[model samples]
Target: MQNEINIPIILASVRKIGDAFLKQYKQNTIPQSMDELLKQLEDIDVLCLTSLKKDLTATFFHMPWHIGDEFDTESQKESTIKGDYWLCDAMDGAIQYLQHIPGWTINLAFIRDGKPLFSVIYDPLATEMFWAKEGAGAYMNGKPLMVSKKTDLGVMLSVFEYGHQDKSTNQLNKEIGMTVTRLLDNFGIVRNYGPHGLQLAYVGAGRIDLFIQEDIDTYNWIAGMLIAKESGAEILNADGIPWQWGSESLLVARKSITEKYLEIKSLK
Candidate 1:
């Protein structure tokens, strides 16, 4: 199935859609109320999804396609049944985009049996296109990506993402707080970026040394996981075990720093 796929063609289609969305994004004004913001978000989602579905279906009609937000509710139930399907987040960092921020991106991944085969993440504002193919390697704007070689925890920059508010629980809140506290105490710098996927890509590009998130939504990070993994970053769960599709938490760090990071995590 991987051999039959043409990543370049798929990337081209996604990039075209991303470019169009970027134009609309720039013209959009900030909503005055929460209700208004949500309404506009819905409209944008429909527009991006419609265009993506139409273009991708024209070329790869046989493969099924699922939107990122719907994956948890729909695909999780059908976990036993999987082949080749396209999973796309038409507008990653939707909040940032609506607010006219620069961190938004378009993310797409081809999954085979719950594992990413190939993926593309387009940062429209930065004009940076990140991609990865299983066993091939990760790249950004045609340049190969590599994780940072820094092994010292005190000098490493880390990132943490908060889970959706609707899914937040007391335990999750405590976990987030403790994690951030730990990062602040040890890491050189810590930040929470707009798009989760882009932060993972940043780790792959060696721009960030660590990325940890609890209660992760699989669809939002799966594409970036492959990119980071292919770029030689270590993908692990909070328990220090190797990461898999259904892990509730994620910790991505450079290969050179994994052991040291894990040791620090163990101290907690």
Candidate 2:
């Protein structure tokens, strides 16, 4: 599958879109408000999708931000095709981007016959791109990326977050809140970078050891999950089953850390 297309050229085109958006932001062309920035990102997404569509014949799927006047008519649901499908998150850390944070990323994954064939995650601020083809191993900035073998749960840096802020009445949030509270108390340190992609990328790079998020969306976790998996990280759904794109939740970490985390999750 790696030889099916020009990987270098396709990745370069993806990076170009990210670089252009970051350049415009550095030039102060992007507004500070979430509404304004999201509106602008929609336009950027169109440019990206257009460029990708021109280069590949795959069916594309992306978040429905209702970015442009032309976007209103587009279907918000995921699209399935007979050949290949592209899963993209044009701007991963929307909240971080709106807050002028430097941790957001851009993601793209190619799915063929229901399997993830390749993935690329771009961090424009750091000018680093992480990519992997199935069975080819992961890389960052052209260097190989590998997960840390640290198995100690107490010594590992962890990232965790729930989907909602109000946990008082939400059953799922309540359960997640309890789980995250205990994790924070037990793990070395905890964080939520407002973007799941960066968290997964960091785990792949061995910068972070654990990541757990409840009710995550498919587009947000798919690309990074593949990158992490290729880097030798373990990932599972809430039920401790193998991870899938539309799973109810995601728990990705080093092998030992994931085992202990799952044990704790089961007690609840």
Candidate 3:
């Protein structure tokens, strides 16, 4: 008797927006993590998202098994792994952990195939929220934003989280290494963190000139992509791809910065 959202309708709109983004850019934005999404349950309405937040948490549990395949090689290593969900052998552990996960860390998104069409990120402590509709653009606290245009690679700042200690898989480490080495050799400045979203927003808002990420999916990229595109920023694959719809390895920066940075790093 809740009489709230119509799941099919809401998801359909998400798909529409996602399709437009694909028509223009040919790819989708990555999504935020589930636990991160769960943490923001209180602000669910504020982000204008669906009741799926609570439902999703429960659904993951009743679904029988967790999908560890969501993560690629970069997130599998013990050193690079931050959440239990990233480990290949930890599917059971992830399901168990998710069962008890706090509602405050939720980060929700709607993606198409491998790209994000719409997204909302709610950060309770910081009390900051971010959301986006592809082609419609990115937003933070209702304010429109853009990415940096600085192209000096040496001057460009970068970030990488939790990949330095273990290369047991080496898949994530290698890709990250290649991307960072290019950034450092060219941009010369780099940093790391344990979480995402906020870091990407900084890049879109021009607070940071450039950001290179090795492990990214639809939920993580969508909102930030809107912010960057509206600001006239651009995103691409580190290997010089034009950012396909399902790409897992993504690089985002100000348009001016991306061109110059890529040239210096020989990325494109």
How many backbone clashes are present in model 3? 37
Model 2 TM-score relative to the real fold: 0.82
Quote each prediction's TM-score: 0.92, 0.82, 0.56
Across residues 57-76, which tens digit of lDDT does each residue of candidate 2 receive?
44223312222121221222
Better of 2 and 3 by TM-score: 2
- lDDT tens readout by residue for model 1, 1-268: 3336777787788788889987787687798898999899888778877887787776778888777663353343333438888887877888888887788888988888878889999987789999999999999999999999886777788998865534534588888888899889888888998688899999999999999887656778888999999999999987778988767788898765767767777888
Question: How many clashes in each structure?
Answer: 0, 0, 37
The candidate, 1 or 2, that scores higher on TM-score is: 1
For model 3, how does the per-residue alpha-carbon lDDT over 1-268 read when each residue is reduced to its tens digit?
A: 1222233443343333323322333122222576654453222222222333233434233212112223453432213222212111111112212333311222444433344445554443344555566677767667877676565566667775432233575587766777666666655677764334456666767777766666545334444555565556677865556676555556777666666656766532
Worst 10 residues of 2 by lDDT: 64-73
Q: What's the distance in Å from true for residue 219, model 3?
A: 4.8
